[model samples]
Target: MILQGNDPTTGASFTLGNRLQRQLWQCVWLCLFRPSPRPLHAWRAALLRLFGARLGPHVHIYPGVKIWAPWQLSVGGHSGVADGVTLYNMAPIEIGAYCVVSQGAHLCTGSHDYNSANFQLVAHPIVLASHVWICAEAFVSPGVSLAEGAVVAPRSVVTRSLRTPWTVYAGIPARPISTRTRHGTAPD
Candidate 1:
């Protein structure tokens, strides 16, 4: 018998209609979003909003940021997604007010179930609490929650929830190393 190449173990995947809808959205993202001129944050935000993203005032989504499923995203006021940040939100992703997701940071909410024969799709929501800072190129895994005022150091890989508020985390499988008490974090 010839191999059909279809995985039977994956019971019920994305239907034809769902695939088509995603294709349409991809086209919109490629045509209208990827080509949008730089620094026009308002335009970008408006486009995301049109796509059903719940964004508060002053939410800055820079050009070149890839937002998969904007409808599942929620960004509070004064939050920013810097250039080249990829928010792969197969599940919901909430960025609270006063948060900054720096350049190249990747917030991924989708993963395949390794134990499943068909490698079924699975997802978990990510929550970045208020006043948090996800530094450049940080990789935040699915189901991770960065507490309020938490600081993820540059290039860190956060695998689990950061429960303590106001702490600095660094290194792979990020570990909190210090308590962050910033009284005006500005160059003196």
Candidate 2:
């Protein structure tokens, strides 16, 4: 399981150490990461790496991107997370190589179970396969996995996995809208 404490009534959702680390990270974000210039993608990536994020070479994470729990994040080579993107990765969020997450996009990996009496906290991993493109302001929900070359239209919401590779999806529920031509093979 990606999450630990389900019931907040029993105790805090995260452990004390986790909470402390988050606090420290928040401070660093405010003081260093957030204030850095726009062109300093490597600097921001280094900061995220310090927090335990597994990022490959040439990954571009803009200064305005908000990342919750960098430890649970892994972004592959040549992936670009644009400005105003939010990665709410309560669980692990693995982004494959050559992916583009456009500005204002949101990837969420945690939610509350409304059916549960205690309002249990549940989380799942989000995986974006290589060559995936999430357009501006798109929302990818928990447990979603976008196949290789999948494209999510702007402002669309994805609840389930997009199983078909090289397809484009749009609308509230993000149904398949069109097909895209696949490019080269997997990167070395």
Candidate 3:
């Protein structure tokens, strides 16, 4: 769950970049990405790039996916975000080439500081290196970076950065379950 700074329930407590920019984006998203079909990945990527996202070649963004701020999202070439993915990128969320973000996954770059009385908004960047796969329904916490070739099992919750690449992780607060090996020049 996220404690959004721009939450209507919280009133105007945090900044969502510029008001004019956000308004413009809302219009574009509503008319373009939101209503577009799932196969229109190229169109979605182009729209996101036009809004300041550093999208690489062949980045596939599904129509059902929701990106809070396109400018704060970056995806490398051949990386695909499956349907039902949510990018709550209050900060930056960078994904390297050849990575796949599965359906129902949430890449959240923002969180609330529970210790604070105001539940102050805290943000951190999320980086997913090349050949990484975050399985369905996984929750990637703020500031967590997944190294190259890492596999986050379905429904896993990653709360910390995993420096070791080519490993399989599972369970809540995901931990390394085993080392993954690639098969014949492709990812494991």
Clashes of each: 0, 0, 0
Please give the lDDT score for candidate 1. 0.86
TM-score of each predicted structure versus truth: 0.89, 0.93, 0.89
Error of 2 at 38 (Å): 1.1
Where model 2 places Cα greater than 4 Å from the true spot, the runs are: 1-11, 184-188
| Ten contiguous residues minimizing lDDT sum, candidate 3 | 1-10
The TM-score between candidate 1 and the true structure equals 0.89
lDDT of each: 0.86, 0.92, 0.87
Q: Give the alpha carbon lDDT tens digit for every residue of 70-160 in model 1.
A: 8889999988999899999878999998899999999999887778666667789999988899999999999999988999999999999
Clashing residue pairs, backbone N/CA/C < 3 A, model 3: none
Poorest lDDT segment (10 consecutive residues) of candidate 2: 1-10
lDDT of 3 by residue, 1-188 (tens): 23454544556555444555777888888898889987888899889989999987888888888888888888988899998999988789999999999999999998778877667778899999999999999999999999999999999999999999889999998999999887643432
The predicted structure with the larger lDDT, 2 or 3, is 2
Distance from true position, residue 154, model 3, in Å? 0.5
Compare the candidates by TM-score and give the number of the best one.
Answer: 2
